[model samples]
Target: MLWAGTAKADYRDSIAVLRIGLVETHVAATDPIKLEAIEHAFSGALGIPVEIIKLGSYAALIDAHASGRVGYAIHSARSFAATEAACGCVRAFRSPVAADGSTGFRSVLVARDSVTLPVAELKVGYSSEASISGWQIPHQAMRAGSLDLPKLVRAGSVGSVIELYQAGEIDGFFGWLPDVPGDAGSDPERLFGGWNRAAIETADPVRIIWSSQRIPYGPHAANRSLPDDLVEALGAFLDQMAVSAPGLLDIFEPVYGGGYVTPDPEEYHNIRGLVEALSDRKSAARIP
Candidate 1:
């Protein structure tokens, strides 16, 4: 039942984080309100207290869930892989449907100034293990543009990419789209540029040079010890959150596309395969 979040405690704080055995915390990914909604919906569906956990970021979510410290999770495709690989009590349950009504979201190559550029020429930056967006999608998009990647770098997160761009360390980068706005303005259009409801699109300020085909988002998962009925009910509750189609669209609009769909683990095999291929390529390249 222990969820993940950072430990910054004051004696006066009611919800003390120190109580949880937190390894670390990262930047908050999804908003707190949205998280509350998700937790409530899951609780209503499962008819259980359903201790909701907050993860700092994708990596933290992956690590905690993978390590079994946190039993359940809804995380990015890449994070899911890391968790699945973590042992102890790690596995995947479901991937959210894309806002476009697909199994997953698309990867867009973006320039820092928000300008469009040749997908291939831009030195795409990504997490060391961005299975879908960083590697497969960008690589595929680059090939489509008939441009070979000039240089590929491994960055820790989007913030790192922004820093690099500001420092002129890299021209442009490609990575996974987020589920919320870019955190730029009050309107929430600045972050993912309000592309949360669908795949990343080309804007006047930023050009979407290349976009990979849609892929499944993340899974609604729990520890291996979780009873089968609980998992099924949790998924059902998430599915039930849509009392009205319009009500459901609220979540969909952010990530882009139609609305939430059922989880599909098999669909991720393509992404998994791509990661394996990338490892092989990297190994071959390293061989003198």
Candidate 2:
């Protein structure tokens, strides 16, 4: 919440130590020495005793933060949204910016150039219902735009979707493109991950028919119960590290190693809404 200002030491009176939660599966395989080095670095920066609590799973990490057991956490976008929905007790302060200035990715509907049908008439294939970019984002975008829902097929996996599209079994498929800021057009060269790259490379003469809004990367969030000054201090320390101690960022978040940037408040709110809607739909479908 506090973006700028001198952080006061008043939090020391109420807090003895700060704890950060990380899911074990989320981190790379590393030795205890590296973990200790991270703790030491954070302690030195915060001027307080800092502890890293590695939980067995994301659920545990979410519960720990929701219950105020940990003061901070590195979360995936979905986990952070779930944590926010659980207690509304956390605030995402920073998220990683990719080396190419990409903050996130957009779900895109890519069709073969030969397909001349309207979007509503195209036979679109998605990886699965569980896929965010492949299914949810594009589905949500279509609903939001009041477009007629296309005939959708679940391809079981991204590989299958690509295979189907390449074989002309489907007119198009949903994939993701890197969300570079201020970019009005989609570039095949800027695909987010290998899946999109694979889709583009193997299926030539493709065009983006539709695209969703940017879906930001996950964030490092602080518990709302933490003191305002402490939160501000944490934010400042992280922002400073992006410039001074980028190696530390690599250790903490190797996926997006560029740097940390303050996230827009609404970034995860949209994710939360989508998650909740998906949850509700599943719940309703189960009522027999």
Candidate 3:
């Protein structure tokens, strides 16, 4: 859709208003206020009036992207991989660095400091059966160790699982930690950037009993249906935010830490494999 500098077509004729979809996967802010803040940053950077679409289900968000119901989405690596496979969506910009100044995070099994229980006997809480860090990675970890999935007490959200663990309702929960690598920092906000820290830390002193391999953060993906010029412009607008207003990066929930960077779609190949495996497991579970 490129044209001569002065011959550029007006985007308004094709779409009424630009739409950006945000998924409520791990974060705690369920209100519209968080969405509005994100809209402000993007509007300021792109000079485009944007509408916010808050999608609660990751699957629904991917379907929306594939169908072109929305042009952009701040997606999880697992969800992004699925959408890319389904509709050829491409990554525009990687997520800002996490609190530890790292581009990736890890999934962990957390429990209260005082609790002392065998891994197989503990009552475990998972955010959802569909969550990657909260469920998938942790499940795979258990299987690798010949450990069972533990008692199934699904909280439906990371915030909920942490709350349950703190209340002593469950012995432990599977969640995330910042990919600090050689650095050891335990700030929950830095560990899980997008969600509210206060909402996540229900226990005074929680400890990680298990940690998974590094999981890369999600990216801003554009649907294949978008014009090349518009896609390039959108990517440029995000790159500008990293330099001009890095602090504004906080407006994008679930994304905290370093500035944004351009990402190759291949970066998510490993995650896509995990998502595909999880899908197969789910299908097998349904057969019985």
Candidate lDDT scores, in order, read 0.52, 0.82, 0.71
What digit string (tens of lDDT, one per residue) describes model 2 on residues 1-288? 574775754887788889999888755325577678788888888788988888988889999999999999999888899899989899999988877777888888887888889988999888888888887777777777755588998999988887887787898888888776788648755543654565657775778888777789989999999998888888898878777887777777778867778999889876897878877888999999
TM-score of each: 0.50, 0.88, 0.61
Model 3, residue 263: C-alpha shift (Å)? 2.9
Clash counts per candidate, in order, are 26, 0, 2
lDDT of 3: 0.71
| Evaluation by lDDT, superior candidate among 2 and 3 | 2
Please give me the total number of clashing residue pairs in predicted model 2.
0
Report the lDDT of model 1 for residue 108: 64
- Which candidate leads in TM-score? 2
lDDT of 1 by residue, 129-155 (tens): 545566666665555564467577777
TM-score of 2: 0.88
Off by over 4 Å in 1: 1-40, 88-91, 105-136, 139-214, 244-257, 273-288
